[model samples]
Target: MAAPNDVQISIPKNDIEEQGFKDFDYSQRAQWLRAAVLGANDGLVTIASLMIGIGAVNEDARAMVLTGFAGLVAGACSMAIGEFVSVYSQLEIEVAQMKREKRVGERGEKEEEREKEQLPNPMQAAMASALAFSLGAMVPLLAAAFIVDHKVRLGVVVGAVSLALVVFGWVGAVLGGTHVVRSCARVLVGGWMAMAITFGLTKLIGSSGMQL
Candidate 1:
């Protein structure tokens, strides 16, 4: 019944749909990359730092190697446990929050959908978070295992660990929807404090003729 000029117009929806799909793909890839970086960086830095501080005081190759081995086992296990606990705790809290949010969401679908939060199973989230954390804390230690000189290796580990923590903390903060500057500063400050304490203890013990 419409005139020729009033003919129905059809728009191609594929372009938009395709673009959205690509964007989602890219986002997922980016998140994976970020998690990888975090895990590797943490592993490299923490273990290295621990080795460096220990090596600084004990110059013996045997001792260094032993310490490094111990560090590797301790760090990896600690990372796994800590990450599991932390992630599990967070998952519990987030699940509770989302449950409450779900009720609110049901009350107002439009508003809730507009502010819809994605809450997955606690076990899943916890497992993922813990895995990421443990992996992050494992890299530098592994690197140190291959290095030869105890002292030099230790120093390398310290530097690498500090750098790694800074990078990981900053990146993590960004992912967590927080301020990178604050997270970075927090990590850096803690590193400096730890170094100071380690060295100070060494000095105090040396003066007292007691080896720490």
Candidate 2:
């Protein structure tokens, strides 16, 4: 029998679970986590899709290996360079814009005294943007490396990459408080365009009697 003066208290287990879930989501880390997942996924899809398309034309194992290897090298380097340049360019634009805005703000400080002023911090903005862009681009290329078969590998990588791009774009839009559907659509469309162009070019080169 419990004493009359004693009190019993119970805490729901779900309360902690809910709290943890909330903590794990909607943070800066969320973006990075999403980036890594999407990047790896993109790499896989891109390579896979490329390989499949190549296989459709011919079933030579040597050709497939050559194609896959070329893709791996070309894709990885392209991703790295693209990531660096895109990030660099984005940082430059952001810095330039911020500086311009800051200059204007300073010139009109007296008139805009009532409004809050945002001073441009070029260093911080550049660093953050560069880091984000590099990491985002690296994800897909890394995922493509795991595939073994040359042609099939390329095909799988392409498909995975395309899917990853859309997923990442959606994730980015959500984080930025924009339309998820539009962002995802843009990525998908862009990926398809890239695939088409690449396939077309490869076909042209092959038909031109260029030995791989």
Candidate 3:
């Protein structure tokens, strides 16, 4: 027997390799990032288009401001509820899969492990989506709130939203390791198209002597 002071240490053959193990892939964050980006894009486009549409016919600052506020509240709530429900559904599917996996395991230990990682947190995903949407919607709201001039306010809001869309697109692209310019251009074009369509429709309706 060895003396009490004497110590023996044994290291596994794969210790060095295990120590160097790293999962640099961002796949785990893909779902949450996609939700966040989509939420923000929806918020920006929807609210901005609504504001522009209202502003095209109604020159009253109060009307535009009120419409924008209502849109923000409604959009945010809708986004939150929608995200929660959608993510919860996905969570249920994962739970079902886990249960199935367990049943499979009970049949025999020789069965290979199927699910390697834990399921995503639906609550976390929902919250992130809602928060991102609210943040995005605030850009146009703030622009309309500060400027009293109707035409100038419209222009400012459009510009601000466009800039925000570009920034958001770039951020998403960077996070997802995509082409920044392509993403930015795509978002910019989509935003402008939404605004243009809304503005044109409202203008046509107003010119047709429709009381709104």
Candidate 4:
């Protein structure tokens, strides 16, 4: 009986419920996970390689501990500065892109809307990367601290690094919604290869009577 203009459009309850059940936004998580996993993987590999290389040549506990501690401090600082610079550069590029978009006719509002939805935070990302690196680096350092025997310490460091790499890979995969086992295996192999290379080189150099 109602006039055509008087008829109201009603949204279906299913559609409304579907909106409420929408999957969680994973974009931000992917960003953080990339930075964090990279940081952790680097920290674990670098420190473990350093310790294992040193252990291969010399069995002095003092030397191993000192070297590891130095690597931890130096690596952490380097990672922080590097991450900050990298993220800041990315931010600059994004800003430049936005400016360019704005200069284009009839696309400024659309560009602005898109940019507004997700603005990258360089400072936050840098801090997160640095902290994650430090945390990851501590695993090997702590594992080495408990053992006085240099050879045993080296073994423990390798084990710790392997475990950490697997965990980080799995965590990253889960966060990014990928194949967890494949990611874990990839990281595990990579870490072992790095350590082996470093250890072999150091052993070769030491056996050649080269002191450095």
Q: Tell me model 2's lDDT, rounded to 2 decimals.
A: 0.57
Instruction: Return the clash pairs for model 4, or none.
Output: none
Name the candidate that leads on TM-score. 4
lDDT of 2 by residue, 1-212 (tens): 99999999887999988887667645544434443444443444455446545654555555554565565556555554555465567657755866677777655665355234333333444344444444444444454456556555555556666767776777777675558999788777867776677677777777778654
lDDT of each: 0.59, 0.57, 0.85, 0.84
Model 4 TM-score (2 dp): 0.84
Query: Would you list the rank order by TM-score, best first?
Result: 4, 3, 1, 2
Model 4: runs farther than 4 Å from truth? 1-25, 108-112
User: Which 10-residue window in model 2 sums to the lowest lDDT?
Assistant: 114-123
Worst 10 residues of 3 by lDDT: 107-116
Order the numbered candidates by lDDT, best leading. Answer: 3, 4, 1, 2
TM-score of 2: 0.48
Residue-by-residue lDDT tens digits, candidate 3, 55-130: 9999887788788878878887888788888888987897797788787765444333445565677777777778
Estimate TM-scores for all models.
0.54, 0.48, 0.82, 0.84
Query: What is residue 89's positional error in candidate 2, in angstroms?
Result: 11
Query: Number of the top candidate by lDDT?
Result: 3
| Residue range 46-142, candidate 1, lDDT tens digits | 4445555566576665564566556556655565465556556766787676578777766567546634544333344334444655565454555
lDDT accuracy of residue 184 in candidate 4: 100
Alpha-carbon RMSD, candidate 1: 7.3
